[model samples]
Target chain A: MSVKYIPVQWNNNKWKYNAVMLASVFAYLWIFIFVTPDLMSNEGRINGAVHNARAFGSCAFLMLSVILCIGPLARLDNRFLPLLYNRRHFGVMTAFVAITHASYIINWYFAFSPSNKYEALLFSNTSYGQLSGFPFEVFGIFALFCLVILAATSHDFWLKFLTPRIWKRIHYLIYAAYISVVAHVGLGILQDQQNHTFTVIFILAAIVVATLHVMAALHEKKHGDPLAAESGDWVKVCETTDMQEGYAKIAQLTAKERVAIFLHEGKLSAISNACAHQNGPLGEGKIIRCLVTCPWHGFQYDVTNGSSPAPFTEKVPTYNLKVEGNTILVDRHANEPGTYVEPVPLNIQGAAA
Target chain B: MDQAQAIFFAFQIWCSIGALIALFFLTIGIDRIDEDAQGAYVFRLLLIPAILLIWPLVLWRWFILETERDAWPNRHRPPRHAHFWVAIALAVFIPVIILVSLSVRQTWPVDFEPQKLSLLEERKS
Candidate 1:
């Protein structure tokens, strides 16, 4: 929330989110250990620890699949926002499970190798040039490394230190990790196994992720704000009646990005539509007193001047805006961040609370 | 240390030095700056271990996509969809790798790996 770094302010929701995740993970392992082997005993003799390893691998992969799906699902509908809120928690849990998966396999299979398990995991298979027995373990290892980086840095402390753009770029490794995972499962297991169910699940998960992202992009394109009307030197955003008190109307400035036109306390103020934190769309947010609260995270900046309140310093670019007849005219040249302009009071008698 | 051990450590040294050089460019900023670099602080310090492990790919991000170069006509700029292509490649490439590995199972022996050989024996029988 501030320029200076702060630890995650873990609240009740975070605690509950952690507890539920812990329970679900244990339950999954429990079923994998005690129940799944029994169900599949007809296939062949099951090595208990190796079976457990495969179980953990599949579980982690499935959990990651769901985690990947949850993002686009939440974006497509707010009903899934609750799931999105604790996504880092989900990722960290997946990392833990994946570690168990890798550890078990290394201990079971690679331990007996002439060289150490860790070394053998990479070097034992010199089949870099061949396909059938190409060491698929490295794919899981790659995915694990990606997951480890993501899980370790999922804390808000890293977010503050790395900054949102870098944080997001690094976190985009999750999709790469997912791809590695899909490959890990396909090449490692599906190639050898007579059973095709998991292959179907894997393909479906890929399709679902790809489809959702495409659909969400299309949806944003369809439902996004209308183009602003252009005047001589100013862009006409909207009428005063188009805005409700404590809410914002958005407009794209010529040669620049979006702007948020806020009406609060019977006064109008305009600022850059992007929140300084994570570039969240400020126009979708509502004002509480002088501050416009970003919807993505609760980052706030003063609508009157595009500055955060005292102690927590952050600023967003501002625009000069005036009313021409009833239509709002916003200057094409946006003011530098934290620049102030007096809010022009509306003449309307009644304002929504 | 054996030959493989020496090779691995040698690889690590080369990668770390390369990663450090890339980190300098990333820290100082370059002409081909990625748009997302705007919010980023100095994170090369945290990325040391990652750089040590996968320096080649990490260096690519800096040298190409992370860096903002003048997009020359018919020349490749830093791809906006670097991660997307990697993801797509993973979905297809791994299966192909496995098929290739399967095809040449008999062509080469996994040297210095008797345990793997025994496992291979079981499959063969």
Candidate 2:
């Protein structure tokens, strides 16, 4: 987080992440373009542009599949959370690769056509009325258009300007893009291929993506139901002994609202589970030196007042908390963002005894 | 022109107008609308493609913010069940599409007479 928005809030981790990502992408492209063809027999060889187009196209599809899986994977396990960070960079790179694929196709196939290249791309196959020979290029174009929009608005400035809700809604277009890509591949190449290897892989990839989403949804549904408080207006989160130091116990106020009650410095503090930036799950974060750091992007907030440190103005709503015997109860109602609330002292030894 | 070509032509025209609007909006209107965008020139350039695509909405929001700054409502709720349903729908839709396409696929006609030769004779020949 920053007071003034620069191009990117680059850090050591972002640099390392980009470096590894670029290296992997370059390695994949090189191996696919050069190594695979040499290993294959002469009969399996394809034209240079066509081979490059396939390499980049397949890589883009794989990257997008991985990008879609990251969110659900993170939800299923904490270890996958690192992949969630620098995801926008992954998305932008995938868009670049996809554009390269499109470029190769345009230059190779449509360059000699009488019409403009882009115009030819659209009108080359007008069999939209038929199911067998439908213009799958249109689907590819639509997906690319969606991807470009997403990549362009990926900056945090758009997040702040569009408001997180609108930003999130716009990003959901990725799902549409994914579906379009599935159609593009299925209708375009799957129809022509005599060999079933790629067809099986494509289908399996789509199934895996869909299955992971469904499983994650089920997991969330199982844990997301609102817990009824033992008393009115205050929800019993957990005993003092149950909470580990610097970690949080998440209380679901409703299906939509959640409170993160953190145990820090022998005291308990409750704040909104949603981070101010991108609404990342603050409940999953760890607190260090009185500041709770969001697991997704490391946006930090003071556990006591739910405000970020000086110069970083991000804030989450604070909740009033009281200790009764060994139990910690949080007020269901939240204070306004950045409101100061006294942390409840935790008697961990007494609770254990 | 065909329907597809007509639609493509219309989209091209829309984007042409959108590019012009995007230039003005990024330079001047963005600052007036969003304070975070103030002096953030590099990020504005990144937003060109999105602004070119959704220029109508951007212009509307810019106009609205001129009257009431920061009036856009923000929601921080966890995502709804729509994503799950969409995923399920696509899962069902994709396999069905693949099956239908394969079933309806056209096969080339063969116009040769049947050979009466046995495997040994065919091999020898």
Candidate 3:
């Protein structure tokens, strides 16, 4: 949304989001480090690097769990869309916390090793052949690597450079990272600890993330299927009276491409449902002042041309539309991005008042 | 050397090279290729870790940009379906791994006891 790239396009919303997130992280760390040990009996008390590592490690795991949940939650409900806005910052912070956790472990456990600390971390455990001690550090290392890469590339510059498709492909490593983390905890900590707290928490978090995703997929499959073509080269989207003012009715074409048919000022315009930024659901966004605003990041496009107003160079494919009686039909073929299509004027008497 | 050590040694070398390439790329090569990167400093710093890991790809892209100046490949390709399968695999793998780990957990010989000899017995012997 910027003509020139700055470090972050900070807004009031971003500041509030980040402040809340940071405060929560600090509070969690404080509770885990200071409050938890006192709650335990004297014989069971934990402190030093062990306590610190657990504090940050568990915090990072929880943060990652929350991060994974945001996508599905946003898909399921619009109330969760605010969480999706500053997710990159959340991810980067999680990486830093994870790094701190790793640092505490390395400094404490591998401090006396003859070789390099990192080398010792990898080489000290050679029980890969055995299932019980399968060098769970490898899984931790893989997860850390993925997190680092993801955190590093979370910038918009990388998104533009790598292209959205490739960037998205790279970010899919988050799933692998999450799975690796689950294995790392399961094999390393759960195997050693008699306490089932972490085990239960990890199991529940994984299940919740997986279940939310499956639910979201099911929801999309049920509601997002393309509309069948009713006539030649056009698909009936809805009745003219059914179109909401300043809102879009999402129509899925035969090619599985979604078209957001917007109603504004007794006129209808159809554009690609995908937003140029992060592919946010443009159909879910509300139209204001003849411009449709993407709900996720607030990237806006002029409804008629499917192009962001000058100074911002984002665009989505536009589709031709027609009205027969009260039925709204959109052309099967989409025009090139930024191509302007004449808005089909509707009779005010026939449209919803 | 063992396989783990060997792999680590190779990785160390790769990272060492990547670090150098990342340094060069962030400082100079990025601006040369991408107009948007010309004056931006903070984003370049953020790119360090990823560039270090994928320096070869960066170099390849830089080389391509050096020749054509604007041939950004794969910018408009449709999203791939490979990640879906990977996700499905991970979903299945997570529970299976936890179960496998639990089932194969090693048991320690907790009943083993150490025998002690009395000082008097030792002296008599």
Best by lDDT: 2
Looking at model 1, give its docking quality level.
Answer: incorrect
Q: Give the per-residue lDDT of model 3 (tens digit) for A116-203.
A: 7777887788887888888898998999999998998888877766656667888998988998998898788767665566668878
Instruction: Name the docking class for model 3.
Output: acceptable
Cα deviation of A342 in candidate 3 (Å)?
2.0
In model 2, which regions exceed 4 Å deviation?
Answer: A38-46, A225-242, A323-329, A347-353, B63-75, B80-83, B101-125
In lDDT terms, how accurate is model 2? 0.80
On the 0 to 100 scale, the lDDT of residue B69 in model 2 is 55
Worst lDDT run of 10 residues, candidate 2 chain B, spans: B71-80
Taking the tens digit of each residue's C-alpha lDDT, what string does model 2 give over B27-100? 78887776666766776667788888888878776776687755312345545446667667667766676677
Query: Per-residue lDDT for A237 in model 3?
Result: 83
State each candidate's chain A TM-score: 0.85, 0.90, 0.92
C-alpha RMSD over true interface residues, each candidate = 8.9, 2.6, 3.3
Q: Where does candidate 2 clash, by residue pair?
A: none
Q: Tell me the tens digit of each residue's lDDT in model 1 across A65-152.
A: 7887776676578677678766787898899899998999989887986785576667776776756666677789889989988876
The predicted structure with the larger TM-score, 1 or 3, is: 3
Candidate 3: residue A179 Cα off by (Å) = 0.8
Tens-digit lDDT string for candidate 2 (A243-270): 8878888877776677888888778899
Clashes of 1: 13
